[model samples]
Target: MQPFPSQPLDHDSLHEECGVFGVIGVPEAANFVALGLHALQHRGQEAGGIVAYDPERGFNGAHRFGYVRDNFTKASLMETLPGALAIGHVRYSTAGSKAPVIRDVQPFFGELAMGGCAIAHNGNITNAAALRRELIERGSIFASGSDTECIIHLMARSIQTSIPERMKDALRRVEGAFSVIAMTRTKLIGVRDPLGVRPLVLGTLHDGAHVLASETCALDIIGAEFLREIEPGEMVVISGGEVASVRPFAPAQSRFCIFEHVYFSRPDSIIGGRSVYETRRQIGVELAREAPVEADMVCPVPDSGTPAAIGYSQESGIPYAMGIIRNQYMGRTFIEPTEQIRDMGVRLKLNVNRALVKGKRVVLVDDSVVRGTTSRKIKDMIIAAGAAEVHFRIASPPTAWPCFYGVDTPHRDKLLAAQMSPEEMRDWIGVDSLSFISLDGLYRAVGEAQGRDGACPQYCDACFSGDYPIPPSDQIANGGFDPEGPTTLSDHTAP
Candidate 1:
């Protein structure tokens, strides 16, 4: 396995860690997992893996370094991982570098003292480095740089008698956000962190098989009925056609990642009982009420910003137009690892529509601005396309702080919002005007009408508010920079 390396900070956009999916009591379980992972492909694109458990075959695993459609869809690959219980992961590296090695791919399996188990995890472990050091001192051998691998090793060392008990023991020793799905020979398990920093939902298929996934969309893909969200600090174990709930951790105020409604989750998915697309549109409505702009048309940055822009246009009574067109074939540019490729910027993914933008005062609605690089490039493109004026409106508040949870955010110094005031950013991006939704407005958009409470906020807004629900132990200990500075840990784990 490759050693962990510091990745160069990419200022364009934030990335969520990964997505987990699991199913039990289903025939051809690996195939169902593949479909679930495909629905959640938006969460991670670099690598995908599935682990299945059969009484006869024991545990069979398949790990691939590419899109789920390209890897997990093939019948040959699915056939190789046959079983009645399965768990899968689509990975976006938050800890390690951009490497494509198989070892870094997930659904990491281990033969533990209790039983054989395979685990897939979403979210970052802020104390992974420290935990790794402690485990190493105890003679634990690691096969991958992934922090998820640390959980497997922790389980192996646990003195608990059952797999579920051992998992709880392992989780209690770690810190930061996590939504885990693990499978053993006869059971499947799912757990969310105390704060529910990342999302995990439970569903049931038509055949009465239980399903656990990062989002409701994953459940929708397989005609699964949305049962409910996995409660914070709760674990559900499925076996023998029965689902048992276990509360292994003390109750804490929930701090689900707010970015999920902003960009991480698929628009079709419902989070916190709110439609993700509707919430984004509501955010646009809130943005319009909070920061109205006079313009010929309201335009989105594309794909990510589309729903919010529509809401803005409707609320403002301004006509919405396709002022910017996106290249659907291109992957997200922010995930590009090398400076050379990322320096090319938004041009590879988006283009300004001269017909719609020329001679028009365009209002550009986007999810959020991180580095100002992409926004600056986009502003220039709009002006060049003959836009008389470019007004920038963001759905979320300025991202002034780094996220140590599942989201891949830049360090404090690298964040544009952290470094400059709104006016300064407007001048730097060369836009006529720029406005971000107020923190209260953001909360209102997400259905928290009273707005965020200073003492007990409704959701995790650390990226926007700097009020971290959990302390970043490793960062605090190491002076906030990884030992390896801006170096790729692996070749293909960029996002």
Candidate 2:
């Protein structure tokens, strides 16, 4: 496997995997699915796709390389997908290259001996390369470069007489984080990996339709009543407006991604019945308590850092100020695929408020620092704007390891934390002082008051601690593990 080309700006942050949404028993299901995808646009912005099942048309799919609102909102486009059941995906390339063609945009549909199934997946398959090699050796032709296509091929070759059984068989052979929404001719299915590293939620429409989404924000957009989060190792098949649940794999302790509370989820989303915004604010409070500093004002790094900054201000008795303003029209810097565009960097989206920062000892709060590029640039911008001093407070621990599950993280060598100590980073970024929240404090912020349990941890902190819940088979097979890697995964395998 070729090493991904370095994008200096993007190396500083993590990118979320795709978002999946599906609905059954809803009239014009594509419309509702569209709204759900629109709400989940933050998860992935590279591409969007929808697949709908109509009795007359069988399976109709529309995959486009753009935003859902721009592609799926048109009457002509929505008219192309007519059905009572639909599944959709908003994608960011974590597996294959960043420049994906239309075919890679998913809701990947495959026809099997049992029936046609369309799947929208939100996570990585750790054993995908091995599985792909085995399937290819068995003469299974592939339609896309995505690791997700491996699941479809596995299901097609299954001897099971039903789609759900075939799906279970397929999932059993793979490893890593996965929250999938699939649609068959008669049923809509949702499944979470046994360890539940990724998130998936179930909801119900007032008219008796069942909905599955990667986040509750999607359900809120469509006015669906929140049901509950899909459990680890569980699969649900929705038919005739009723849901049938099954435990397809042996149960294991849940390992939800801790970073979701830090940056991935929308502020309004509720995960594990806890408000995401509240969790972030609590993280800020924890940071303030752990790393108190004297400053005239607390300023966030625009959007992702805003909630935590507010929390830090409240806890420290300092006033929160908007010393840097983000351009509402600009998208996230990490989403820009090309190195040329990313090199343009922080200036494209954020501008310092000279009036607020000038002559002020500002405390800059951000979620986390990856490669240090963004933080360094922001510090420079603050100094240029005449700030007296800048203190950097990170809401989460230093991100020292790469994520093998679903997040698009830089390789070990490129991560700033992997190479530098906290003091070194502070000197490099030219901040007066720098501090990150402790790992245990992060757990406490997410409601784990006892801190992370060593025997059975509550969340996945692989990016910080290198304690991956599942082995990264593909990465290991490719000899991608470095001796200098920041952290190590626990010796465990999914049951």
- The most accurate candidate by lDDT is 2
- What digit string (tens of lDDT, one per residue) describes model 1 on residues 1-495? 111122332336888879999999888899999999999999988789999988787899999888998888888878888788999999877533664589988899999876789999999888999999999999999998888888998888888899999999999888888999999888989999988989999999755599999999999999999999999899999988788999888778788889999999999999989999999999999999998988999999988899999999999999999999998888632467767875666777889999889999999999998877788888989999999999999999999888888887767776788778999889888899999999999899999879988767778887887777777779878878443443112111111
Q: Would you list the clashing residue pairs of candidate 2? A: none
Q: What is the lDDT of residue 247 in candidate 2?
A: 95
Please report the TM-score between candidate 1 and the true structure.
0.93
Candidate 2 lands at a TM-score of 0.95
lDDT of 1 at 378: 88
Task: Give candidate 1 regions above 4 Å deviation.
Answer: 1-11, 95-98, 332-344, 481-495
The residue ranges of model 2 lying beyond 4 angstroms of the native Cα positions read: 1-11, 95-98, 332-344, 482-486
Tens digits of per-residue lDDT for model 2, 54-73: 99988999999878878899
TM-scores for all predictions: 0.93, 0.95
**Model 2 RMSD vs true structure:** 3.0
Candidate 2 weakest ten by summed lDDT? 1-10
Please give the distance, in angstroms, between residue 305's alpha carbon in candidate 1 and its true position after superposition: 0.8
